[model samples]
Target: MTHQVTIRNTGHRFPAQDGSTILQSALDAGLVLPYGCRDGACGSCKGKLVDGRIDYGRYSEKALTAQERAQGYALFCQAKPLSDVAIEAREVRKAGDIQVRKLPARVQKLERAADDAMIVYLKLPANERLMYLPGQYIDILLKDGTRRSFSMANAPHDDEFVQLHVRHVPGGAFTDHVFQTMKERDILRLEGPFGTFFLRDESDKPIVLVASGTGFAPIKALIEAAFKKGVKRPMRLYWGARRPKDLYLNGLAERWVAEHSGFEYVPVISDALPEDNWSGRTGFVHRAVMDDLSDLSGHQVYACGVPIMVDSARRDFIQNCRLPENEFFADSFTTAADKAR
Candidate 1:
């Protein structure tokens, strides 16, 4: 059965085939919807369901809470319409024409950024170049039908190689291989350039960037892209980690601060041992932003990190810090354990 899906805001219409997700169907019809981690783990694709019923496919509880579902919200990436429906969702005009392809990549280099994090550089075929926004990510397709997603750490202008920061997850098959057994020059299949966490170029608002652990990957790309484009907007970055050493790319951020006129970097450490001699900002990274900028009404915030940090920042910034809800863009790094929950 085919159902007509209407966008209440734009009055655009598309056809949703039986068993097809709303996001997939929209893409098939050449309409773009803001989305990330199409597996129903990230809440980026969430939207208001104005009318009609849906299957409400399997999803992480954190992404779509019972309270949110009760409020008529659904994760379009996983929801399948039961009949013709109308919904309220933001269409991503910038990402509409970018194509998603499955291509082969060769491991060019592997640099150990930290004890638990590895920076892998992938080189695509000589004839192929992936055209993607700064904050997009690629999914490595495994032979066992599993996939691991990682954001590109390099900016679009630096497209000679795709850089990914992979954190070692204990007992994770992919990370285990990457840290222990993977060798240079190995071939891997990948698909993507996914996510809607890029900069809103049209907006001239000051930018606040928050990152935790490997979440810095996409933020790095975004900042570099902004710099490459000569975006003069003021930007501040707050990066958090359990220990100072876990902030693998700290030096690079420092370099950016030294080079960029309107850029600032703050390193926040939590759980730092006494012997480590830590003396910088300490506590949750998001709190540092709140402490410095009490009023974020005129700022655009970009956050990427674990679910706890992203969720807290989203709620606190909008409710307490006077930030507009639409100005807060985020990419939550959900793990296998997160999705299982």
Candidate 2:
């Protein structure tokens, strides 16, 4: 049986089948959606149910606690509609452009950007192209029915191949393989071009781009795509790391600043080792943004990083800096452990 799911604000409609997840239905029907972990782990796909009931699949209490579920909050990745439904969420675009396909990809090259992060470039079929927005991600299907999600570090038009920034998580199943046993030219399954955290071309408001650790991957993609499209809006980037080495692409970002007149870069270090002798912007990177922009009422923010950092920054940006709820876009990279937690 099929029920219609109507998206509020945008009025976009999708189908919800009795046995399928809401997010799966949206994608199947060629509707763009906001989502992260396809599993019940990350809360990025949480949507408010305006008018319907759903049987929810297993989910982390942290993502959607029992109390929140009772209050009409549902995780789209885990929820199945029982009847016609209405929801409120940002309308998806290219994510709606075409149906997603599960394709085999060959690893073209792998380069280490930092001690913990690797930039893997993959070559897709010559005739097939992945049309995705700037800030989306893909899940590499593993051999054991598991997947590793990594943000696309390169934007759409530059697609001779897809680039992913994979941060090595100690003791992680997939990451251990990536760092230790994975080899170039190995065939892997890739399904994606997911997430709604992309540049809103409709808004020319000043942009605040923030990142911590490898979350900088998608932010870098967004920035490159923005610059390539000649998006001349004022942009300020605040990137934080523990030591100077953690800011892997500091030189590249500095060069970007020199070339891009409308862009600014702020590398923030929270714990600089004495050997580094680093005296730049220090402490929480998000705080650095607060220090500069006392009023964010007129700005749009794009943040990618750990959930705690993204959550904390979002709270402070809205409550203290006067930013609107809708003006902020984020993609929280939850660790595999965080996912299991």
Clash number for each model: 0, 0
What pairs collide in candidate 1?
Answer: none
Regions of candidate 1 where Cα sits further than 4 Å from its true position: none
Give the root-mean-square deviation of each candidate in angstroms.
1.1, 1.8
What does candidate 2's lDDT look like per residue over 95-116, in tens digits? 5454456888998998887889
For candidate 2, the TM-score is: 0.94
Against the hidden true structure, what lDDT does model 2 obtain? Answer: 0.86
Q: Write the per-residue lDDT of candidate 1 for residues 1-341, one digit (tens) a residue.
A: 99999999999999999999999999889888988888889798999999999999999998999999999999999999999999999987734678999999999999999998999999999989998999999999999998988999999899999999998999999999999999999999999878788999999999999999999999999999999999999999999999999999899999999999999999999889998799999999999999999999999999998889999999999999999988999998887888895
Clashing residue pairs in candidate 2, if any? none
Top candidate by TM-score = 1
**lDDT (C-alpha) at residue 208 in model 2:** 95
How much is 175 displaced in model 2, in angstroms? 0.9
